[model samples]
Target: MTTILVTGGTGTLGRLVTERLRADGHEVRVLSRHSRPYAVDLRAGGAGLDAALAGVETVVHCASTPRGGDEQAARNLLAAAGRAGVDHLVYISIVGVDRVPFGYYRAKFAVERLVEESGLGWTVLRATQFHDLVVTLFEGLSKPPVMAVPAGVADQPVEVGEVAERLAELALSAPAGRVPDMAGPEVRPLDSLARAFLRATGRRRPVLRVPLLGKAYRAFREGGHLAPERAVGKVGFEEYLARRFGPDGGR
Candidate 1:
C-alpha cells in the first residue's frame, strides 16, 4: 500500500477523501494548519513539510483558501513535493474556474497553472459546487422573509462523497491532466435551488430572483459554472435535501 499525504485533510472534502483512501488500505496522512495528528501546514514549507513528505508517495491537494492566499500555498506545496520526488500530485479544483471571473475562481485557476507547470506528475479534477455550499448559501440568506437569489443563474451541485470517491480513484491511478469535469445529475436554476432549501428546512420565505448586475453574476447566469454535458453525479438537490430534512421536508 502506498503512503499518501492529503492536504486540507480536515476540511469537508478532504476528510471524506482521507476516509476513502484509508478504507482502500493506503497509509494516509492529513495536513492542516491546526496541530493535530498527521497535520502539516502547507503555508510553512520547511521542516514540517519535509517531514510530511518523508515517505509519502502520492499527494492529494484538497486544501484551498477560497477567501485568499491559495496560490502561494499551492506553490509551496508543489515545491516541497518536487523536492521529495512525489510520484503523483492530485489536485481537486472547481468546474468553470477558468471561465468564471470571480476572484476566488481566478485564484483557483492560477493554482491549476502552478500544478501543471510544477514538473511533478499531476492530475487535476474539476468538480462543480457541493451540496453543502448550496445549503450554506441559503442558510445565510434565510434571515429575511423575502429571500433574494440571483436570477438566470444555474448550478449543478454534486455530492461531496461523489467527489471524494472520484479523488481517491484518481489518486490511485496514473496522473492524467485535467480530467472530465464532474457535476450534479440535474442543472437547476438558482431560484429553484433556494426554494428547495427553504421547503426542506421548514422555512416560510418567498424566494425572489433578483436580476444581478456584475461580470461574475453575468458569467454565472450564462452557465459558466455549469457542465451540462458532464453531469456525472447521481444525487439531485431534492434527494439530498430529503435525506437531510426528511420526506415531508420538515414542514
Candidate 2:
C-alpha cells in the first residue's frame, strides 16, 4: 500500500480526505501543529517533516493560513517534499484566488505558483468554498432581527466531503498540473444563502443588503469564485441544510 501524508488532517476537508484514503486501504499520515500521531508543524520548516515524509509516496497539502504567512508554509512543505523525493504533491486551493483581490486569495495564488515551480510532480485542485464556511458566515452575521450582507456577492459553496473525495482521487493518481476546478451544483446570492440558513434554523431575521464598494466585492459579484460550467459537485446549499438541520428546521 502506498503511504500518503495529509497536511491539515484535523481540519474539515483534511479530516474527510484522511478518512477516504484510509477507507481505500492506503497508509495515511496526518500532519498537524499539535502533537499527535505523525504530526509536523509546517511553520517550523522541516523540523519534524523528515520522519513524516519518509516512505510517503504522496503529500496532499490542505493546510492554509487565511490571515497571512501562507506562502512560507507552502514553501517549507515544498522544500521538505522535494528532499523526501515524494512522487506526487497535491494541493487544495480556493477557486478564483488569481482573480479575487482579497489578501487571502492573493496569498493562495502565490502558493499555487510555488507548487507549480517546485520541480516535484504536483497537482493543484481549486474548489469553491465549503458549506460549513457559509454556515459560519451566517452565524457571524446574525445580530438579532436584522442581518446585513454585501450586495452582489454570490458563491457556489460545495460540500466538504465532495472536495475531499476529489483530493483523495488526485493524490492516488499521477500528478496533473492544475486540474479542472470543482464547484457546487448551483450558484446562489449571499443574501439568498443567508435566508436559507435562517429558515433552516427556525430563525426569522430580515436580511438587509448593503451596497458593496470594493474590488474584492466586485470580483465576487462578477462570478470570479463561481464555476457554473464546471459544477461537478452534486450537493447544493439547500440540500445540505435540509440534511444537516433536518426537514422541519432545527431549534
Assess every candidate by TM-score. 0.97, 0.97
lDDT of 1 by residue, 95-124 (tens): 989998999999999999999999999999
What are the per-model C-alpha RMSD values against the true structure?
1.2, 1.1
Model 1 residue runs over 4 Å out of place are 248-251
Query: Candidate 2 overall Cα lDDT vs. reference?
Result: 0.91
The global C-alpha lDDT for each of the candidates, from Candidate 1 onward, is 0.91, 0.91
How many pairs of residues collide in each model?
0, 0
| Candidate 2: tens digits of C-alpha lDDT, residues 28-144 | 999988748667778777658888888788999998877777898898898988898999999999899999898999999999999999999999999999999999989889866
Candidate 1 has an lDDT of 0.91
